[model samples]
Target: MDAWEPRPVPSVTPETEPFWSAAADGRLLVRECPDCGLVYHYPSALCPDCFADAEWREASGAGTVYSFAVQRHLGYWPEDDLPVVFAYVELKEGPRMVTNVVGCRPEDVEVGIPVEARFVPTDEGGIGVPVFVPTEP
Candidate 1:
């Protein structure tokens, strides 16, 4: 395998810090609105629906593939030397997240496929990025 670097780490802001920290510990966290009980992604300080303060909650870490595409080539992802499955996963709790599907062939992925979250090390020190993999039937 070619010795290549991973993608640059994302800058964590105050609002997104908890999500990234939870992911590093092998858990996935999402924002939940205490007022309306709405779950959402891209963790924010306020709910998008009702403009209420959102609380951090642990997610089920299980989701379904809402949509997906395979990237056969990319400059930054040279370490894998294979097609990368980019997908939008709909979490069981409600919100959808943009993540990558791993631990299976790109051809095997499909819409509505069951997947569970996996944490992979990032270029960012002390951080693990969340990805999804196929779940058993």
Candidate 2:
């Protein structure tokens, strides 16, 4: 088995600095268009819906698993970290974002399962990466 490599840290740009800064504090943020009222992720300068400048808003950190895939083998991941669950989580605010489902076994995840956001700090202590875990019953 190969050594575990650290996950890539997201690059911070002028437009995304606030988003990353908030993430470092364990807060999840989404971009909202003041014009069209569209809320979305992957912070960008302009809204995809109306091209209007988007503003940052804190999210509720609650969501549901929309779809997922269990990876049993990936060259970059350590052997012990097998079966990573990658999923698309639909935030209660109404936008879908790609994220990972953690804190549980891969087989334990399924579509439509309620989830909540959890932040994992980067190895270098940079911005926290937002991931989801199943909500308690």
Using TM-score as the measure, which candidate wins?
Answer: 1
- Candidate 1 on 1-137: residue-level lDDT in tens? 11113665767887788888788788999999999999899889899999999999999999999999999988877545568899999999988999989889898999999999988766665567889999985
lDDT of 2 by residue, 1-137 (tens): 11113655777888888877777688999999999999998899799988999889999999999999999988876567788999999999988999889889998999999999887776544467788889975
Q: Cα miss at 38, model 2 (Å)?
A: 0.4
lDDT of 1 at 62: 96
TM per model? 0.92, 0.90
Off by over 4 Å in 2: 1-5
**Candidate whose lDDT is highest:** 1
Q: Which stretches of candidate 1 lie over 4 Å from their true place?
A: 1-5
lDDT at residue 100 of model 2 (Cα atoms): 86
* Cα-lDDT of candidate 2: 0.84
Query: How does candidate 1 score on lDDT?
Result: 0.86
Shift of residue 58 alpha carbon in model 1, Å: 0.1
